[model samples]
Target chain A: MKGLDLNITIVGLGLIGGSYALALKELQPKKLYAVDKDEEAIKVGEEMGIIDKGFISPEIPLKESDLIIICIYPKDIKDFVKNNIDNFKLGSVITDVTGIKREFAEEINAGLRKDIDFVFGHPMAGREFTGVKYASKEIFKGANYIITPTERNKEESIKLIEDIAIGLGCKNVEKVTVEKHDEIIGFTSQLPHVIAVSLVNSDNLGVDVGKFTGDSYRDLTRIARINTKLWTELFMGNRENLINQIEEFEKNITDVKTALINKDMKSLSEILSKASKKREEMS
Target chain B: MKGLDLNITIVGLGLIGGSYALALKELQPKKLYAVDKDEEAIKVGEEMGIIDKGFISPEIPLKESDLIIICIYPKDIKDFVKNNIDNFKLGSVITDVTGIKREFAEEINAGLRKDIDFVFGHPMAGREFTGVKYASKEIFKGANYIITPTERNKEESIKLIEDIAIGLGCKNVEKVTVEKHDEIIGFTSQLPHVIAVSLVNSDNLGVDVGKFTGDSYRDLTRIARINTKLWTELFMGNRENLINQIEEFEKNITDVKTALINKDMKSLSEILSKASKKREEMS
Candidate 1:
């Protein structure tokens, strides 16, 4: 709510953290502190001037900071949060940039004290390309920031999260439950990547067809080049939504296969027509 | 085959036809001719020197050409071929630039007189943009040209078609049955378009998202803004393959959905991991 002069501590100086650091620099935070296990990341962040202060270890530095944003891989967030929760000052508002939520939410809700405002958030933008060096202050421009809040979260925490998103140059910010966020992303984002990867794999790309591919082949399989550890963890974390979205594709494809097998022109036309119309309407 | 001096004529002067005309001219065709119902297309092609002679109608010019390449919309090809088959010079090759084949192969093979060779070929290269102005002589660079030959066709005719593909600057020329060509394209090409159209149409594309789309999104969805009439006819023509491809997608997606619904983390991880590996192996 107030101007972001609040001391902001960002954990994990990866692409998201580095970008957040650079983004908040324009706002002139009272003090910006970054912590990461990777000294190289911290060193890069400092060299790039993404943050004012850096620490190699996870000690919650001077927890009186107004906000603490966790920017780490989804699987690591829980342990990192556990390590830092005790040192977070009593009134500090905490948030995260994790792709998945339920598990992280449960961990944070149960791990941290009630005095700390911890609302989970995800900024839905990034290249398959990763790391701090690739980080840009402008990457967040016009990207969506979804804030996951529960009844347990204080209203002020949600406001602070929204403010942080807006401060980071996010064009749109909306409040959503953890479940809703996971489900929507599964359909709109994560599942698409899965599909892309599957299509590319099935085509036996990387060797021959990769060079011959036109724009369509390239675009559809763009997300195939992923950070396996992070994605596998995310898929496992958001297992429910991922499975559902994949199922939707499966059912649609099966019906299509049946029509093809039967040589049912009408059904085939109707199917693509419906998909086309739906796609058009959504656009 | 003999330096392409066989009275080469192209019907429809859009990107494909115009490019083909330009390529033929470079090969020193006997008398390059262009016919299009669009008077503007004829004027433009003549002015651009893509073709030496231009005709506003197909009927009169169809009698003189030794080889006629139909570059019209798939829906219009049947009528165009039917009306012009009687006019085609005896012992000449009649080919098409349509993406779909089974339907075309059946009708053209059965309908045409025994003298003319009807070999269906498709050069898998195009831009989202269209028209004679967008036609590039270099569009076919490194692209695949599929020659769909039936058992009834002569090897000499196939060789002539192969030569045309090479002359167009395409190197990956392969002979495939109509069914196989449709099947392979249905998965590798058509499905990508469908996915792109769906993804693009999903929401009002923020200008920022558009800017951040990178090469992958651009490449994948390049065919999104398609020529609807042509694509519609192509889909119907190769209904079997299209349906099968769609079904494959459905199955893949369904597997994903089940993984999510049941929280089957292992299955989801394996699928994503395998898919990523598969894509990495591709070109």
Candidate 2:
């Protein structure tokens, strides 16, 4: 537990999982294993040396692993946890890299063996690009690692997860409740990606006009290339927060529209100025 | 005129105008004059060597200037053009560096003396940072310089402006109509800044969260640190196109929200995929 001598198992073998495997490898774990439903994904990870050992099944590599990390989509979390609940060893800890939390935290804690601690962790790092091929150890270099916990989680387990994040070279580590974590993410992460997708989809301009688009348009739509299937599940899982963020955004846009219709440059400028001020304060 | 012997007078010694002066200086113009109502801006430009001469008033400089480039806000274009219309020498050509055009084009063309020609130009390049101090001659390299024209503009004047842009090392010199130009700007330029400002403003989380924000958020809101007053005027001048863009964005956001609410990850993914494809096509 004090060092990389601990055995670790990563589930899912996709982008986030592959990235964790790579970072864990750098720490030189005593044994590293991975499991994914997709045979091709496991095969690819094996071929890329992204995982020391990998399998194409849901069975947890229970006895050999001191740490188990889940990196599946939100909908897949409950099923994975339910299936593997009996396999976790006593004193071993489990964590995940899913975006949404509260529901999963409740389900995992309620079902897990009381001796096996569960600490939920999410890395605020990703790319518009996806899959194992796009995964990298460097992605965590300047990213945030949020460790969310309920009253049921042991402080020791949370500390272990934080150490793992720090070992992976995460720039910042913070603690928050599952609900607070989701709300912060809904505002900063989920909402931004949602806005990006919409902005890109709405443009009806021809390719030539797009070619004329400067950096702003390109930046605004950078997340438009996201894995919608995964993101949609995350969005739906945290439906209320996503809806709240969208509602607030709708009101902001309505005010902008009103200013434009009235030809009120003064009002429009003031609004933009206010937004700019807030953005600056955040940055 | 064939080489760099031409005297170029840059009106409004701010970022765009200051940048123009710096680039024109590299071609080593015979002389470069800075004309601006903001006396401090002129003084800074002079101190930075962005201008050869800083004029507090327009009269003396306007009389001898061969080419005058107005780089003021869109709303100020008409008055700036009117005040200097009589001062332009016979056969001398004039151009502007405004964002939106149709109205400015009409107003300037109507007020110009019979012997002088005015061809509108917009350089589609900038950083979020502003003013003469941050201006760089290198910004024009590999950036676009768009030439906007109406039927009233003389062909010789268009050629002259194109020649100047080429000499300035602009990567692309495009000729577009005033109306079309404004519409394109509304999407590529105005809409991006608007989205950035809104995204930045929407977040309630302050500096800690900002530090954790990745490149995606930074890129999306890079333009939020804007010159609000100038943008306000640009929005007013191109109210039609800006409003249309805003409405288009609203519809797009609504579509994404509906997808999220329905829990249709496949459709959401498809939408994002389509957006990525469209964005890729945009160049």
Error of 2 at A281 (Å): 1.1
TM-score for each candidate, following the candidate numbering: 0.77, 0.89
Chain A accuracy as TM-score for every candidate: 0.92, 0.94
Candidate 2, superposed: residue stretches over 4 Å from native: A1-3, A24-28, A37-51, A57-62, B1-5, B59-64, B163-171, B204-212, B262-270
lDDT tens string, model 2, B105-185? 887788778877788898777777777888888777766788987787788789888888877777778898888888888
Worst 10 residues of 1 chain A by lDDT: A204-213
- Candidate 2, residue A57: Cα displacement in angstroms equals 4.8
Candidate 2 lDDT by residue in tens digits, A223-274? 8777867876788788789888888877777788798898776778889889
| lDDT of the structure predicted as candidate 2 | 0.80
Native contacts present in each candidate (fraction): 0.31, 0.64
TM-score of chain B of each: 0.90, 0.94
Residues A60-150 of candidate 1 have per-residue lDDT tens digits of 4647577888888877777877866677787778888788887679877887777877888888777767788988878788777888888
**Model number with the top lDDT:** 2
